[model samples]
Target: MEKMKLKLLYADLQSDIRVIEKELETALDSSSHYLKDASLHLLKAGGKRIRPVFVLLGAKFGQYNIDDMKNVAVPLELIHMASLVHDDVIDDAELRRGRPTVKSQWNNRVAMYAGDFIFARALEYMTNIQNEKAHQILSKTMVEIVQGEIIQIEDKMHLNQSIRDYFRRIKRKTALLISSSCQLGAVAAGADDSVAHHLKKFGYYVGMSFQIIDDVLDLTATDKQLGKPAGSDLLQGNITLPVLLAKNDSAIRPYIEKALSGDMKEDERQVFLKKMRSSNAINEAYHISNLYLQKALKEIEELPANSVKKSLKDIALYMGKRKF
Candidate 1:
């Protein structure tokens, strides 16, 4: 299966990932039982832990010290976890990775508090890193993520938004953190500036491809696969790459408008989902995603040949081809 293949690519990092996992458990510890429970709930739901993987891999390109790398890896994953908790609140999402979200399990206020608590823990861990450049990169990434989310809110349901608008939103919303993971890991391990720059670019391209493939899967995959209703993004009025490309067809425009109008029937939504799956829009979106993947590979090609570089390349390929 695709999941197993991706896991195989990073199999060498199993021990390092375990260390990061334990650190995450320790990091989420809190005196407030409520905050502790809420944060723990999200953490237990599990994820690809891709940010931490990128961090470990990036570190391999430099001095390759697990102790030095964990500082960067732990905080980045924490930031991502905190963002997911808050995003569920914003999306009013009930399920994530097939489990009830923090907000759904508790409530929105509890979720927000939990998110803030986790973010604080992230900063606490980040302080372990003395590198000023690492701090600067992470701080700016955090700000960009917030700005991206705000822009996503502002652009919601507005079909007139340009393709550039979509790209810019995703760059900050998703890509920057992954990019920072690579750069910060390299910086933490004292990699050369040129090497760090290439890894950062590699992560950026891979992240972009990952998000686009996600958007395509939103319409093409089943609810069970997504852990939420199919077409959930459309239902929530968030226009993604596939939808933006699909809207070019006059036949699809009215359906998109109806969906965006927030009055679509369940049956009609199903029809729209089907139409999108069969449309050229999906292919176009995949094409764009492949282009990004190629760029990611190109970035990897610039790095000195090593097992780390090979793993990074395999990750990029998996991102382009993953079904879930």
Candidate 2:
């Protein structure tokens, strides 16, 4: 399976990842059982943990110490976790990774408080690093992420947005955090500035490709694979790469309009889904994702060839080609 392949690619870091996992568990501990449980809910559901993997791998280019690297890794993952909790509330999402979201399990107010708590924990852990550059980079990334989400909210259901708009939104929504994971990890480990720059570029490209594929999967993958309904992005009025591309066709545009207008019937939704699957839009999105993948590989090529480089390369390839 695709997940198995991704796990195999990073198998060498299993022990370090375990340490990060434990640290995450410890970080979620709180006096309020409600906040603790809400915070722990999504963490328990699990994720690819790609952010921490990038952080750890980036550290490999410098002084690879698990203790030092974990400081960066754990907080990056926590930031991502906190974002997801907030995102679910924003999206009014019922499920994440096939399980009930915190907002759904508890309430929106609880989810918001839990998100704040986790973000506080992330900031607490980030203070362990003395690297001012790392802090600056992460702080900027966090701000951009919030701005991205704000833009997404504003752009919601607006079919007139350009591809440039989509790209700008995704860069902040997803890419920056992953990019920082790579850059900060290297900086934390005392890697050269040049090395960190290259790693950061690599993560940026991979993150872009990863998100494009995720958008494609939201349209093409089965509900079981996606852990939610197919076309959820479209249903929620978030125009993704495929929808933007597909909407250029007059036939598809009207359906998307109806969906966005909040009057689409279930059958019309299926019709749109069917047309999108067979359309060139999906292929076009994949082409863009592949381009980003190639750029990521180029960034990897700039790094010194080593097992870690190979691992990063493998992960990039997986991101471009992942089925779910």
TM-score of each: 0.98, 0.98
| lDDT per residue (tens digit) for residues 101-191 in model 1 | 8899889999999999889999999999998888999999999999999999999999899999999999998889989998888889898
Q: In model 1, which regions exceed 4 Å deviation?
A: 1-3
Query: lDDT tens string, model 2, 1-324?
Result: 676778899999999999999999999999998987876776678888999999999999999999988889999999999999999998899999899999999899999999999999999999999989989999999999999999999999888999999999999989889999999999999999999999999999999999999999999998898989898898899999999999989879889999888889988989999999999999999999999999999999899866899899999998999999
Prediction 1 TM-score vs. true: 0.98
Error of 1 at 207 (Å): 0.7
Among all windows of ten consecutive residues in candidate 2, which has the lowest summed lDDT? 35-44
Predicted structure with the largest lDDT when compared to the true one: 2
Alpha-carbon lDDT, every model: 0.90, 0.92
How much is the lDDT of residue 292 in candidate 1? 95
